[model samples]
Target: MAQKDPVLALDNQICFALYALNRAVTARYRPLLAELELTYPQYLVMLVLWEQGAGAESARVSDVGARLRLDSGTLTPLLKRLEERGLLLRQRQADDERVVRLLPTEAGWQLQEKARQVPARLMCGLGVEPQRLMALQQELRSLLAVLEGSAPSD
Candidate 1:
């Protein structure tokens, strides 16, 4: 049998860390969301809509997918759920009907205060400062670019 590289060990894999981090974060959000009867993905969509919007300048499902590394098959269904919850409205663009725009409803903004503490709460657990977080995010972006058929230019 051929031997595997020591560096390829599971303990050294970033995917394992990412998986664990997601699971742990989801666990934290679960109890918090039970009060609002929302799921993690739903909350993610809300976060996108809050940060973006339903219009071109606001948000579209494709834009969300791009930012989240998802696709329409996954995002379209989630967008439907958000629409059903009255958290947002989904519609085809007037000029470009092919583009689906996701606009948050009044209820979505209404819940902002409810979740206002979540970002800081999660960050506190990660124990990374804002500037450090930005640096790490940039590194992750570079890593993602490398994975996505594009080597990040320095």
Candidate 2:
């Protein structure tokens, strides 16, 4: 009998692990986000907008795109839907019409209070220790930085 290549094993593939993890995490978020009437992508967009704070001040679409690693093709429709839902407003910059900015509406600000429990709720539901999750998150961030070519050289 010939030995099979261990490298070809699905369980040994980092890409498969990551893909499965992403799907599992998103699935867990589904019902929780449904309460807010948000899809996973929509929730991510809202998180960025919320971080920018509520006011006349806004975040540039490009800035949000960069933060989320999302291209306009995907982000544009999400933004449009959020805008239509009255959760956010998309406006062209006065100084530069070419630039589109985003700001959360009053309702969106209110939603933040409701969403404040989501993280804790999710963590509790997953039964994962916060410290362990934090460590995992840091490791993932490091890995992502390396993959993105932004990691510092030793």
Candidate 3:
């Protein structure tokens, strides 16, 4: 029988580290979002909408899905919940009824004001410098690109 390599242990896997970090970061966001009656994924959708500006026109559902890396199967229910809460509106496009558009409602815009401190609080809680965090994000983006085969594999 061959002995298992210690180098192949779970703790030594980069994928394990990434998975653990994702869980930890999402856990940190849980309570903060609970105050606003949002889950982390919902908060992410709102963030994308919020970026378009409070009074900005509606965005196509496909566009939102692309930005968030979510499929309709996943995004639809979240959008529905936000809609039920009067935080956003999902409408069929006039020119192309097959296409759906999403826009933040007045309540959604107001929620943004309450969410303004989330990032700062997260940074403080994590005790990480913003510059370092940004650098890490850039590195992760490159890693994802490689994983997705958009970047050359070495």
Q: Score each candidate by Cα lDDT.
A: 0.80, 0.91, 0.90
Better of 1 and 2 by lDDT: 2
lDDT of 1 by residue, 1-154 (tens): 4688778889899889989977986897787776676788888777777876334476878889987888989988778887898888888899998998777788888887788887677677766688887897898889778788755564
lDDT of candidate 2 over 86-130, digit per residue (tens): 998899998999999998889999999999999989999998889
Per-prediction CA RMSD (Å): 3.8, 2.8, 2.2
Model 2 TM: 0.91
Off by over 4 Å in 1: 2-8, 53-56, 125-138, 149-154
Window of ten residues with lowest summed lDDT in model 2 = 145-154
If scored against the real structure, what TM-score would every candidate get?
A: 0.74, 0.91, 0.90
Q: Which candidate has the highest TM-score of all?
A: 2
Model 3 residue 103 distance off true place after TM-score fit, in angstroms:
1.3
- Rank candidates by lDDT, best first: 2, 3, 1
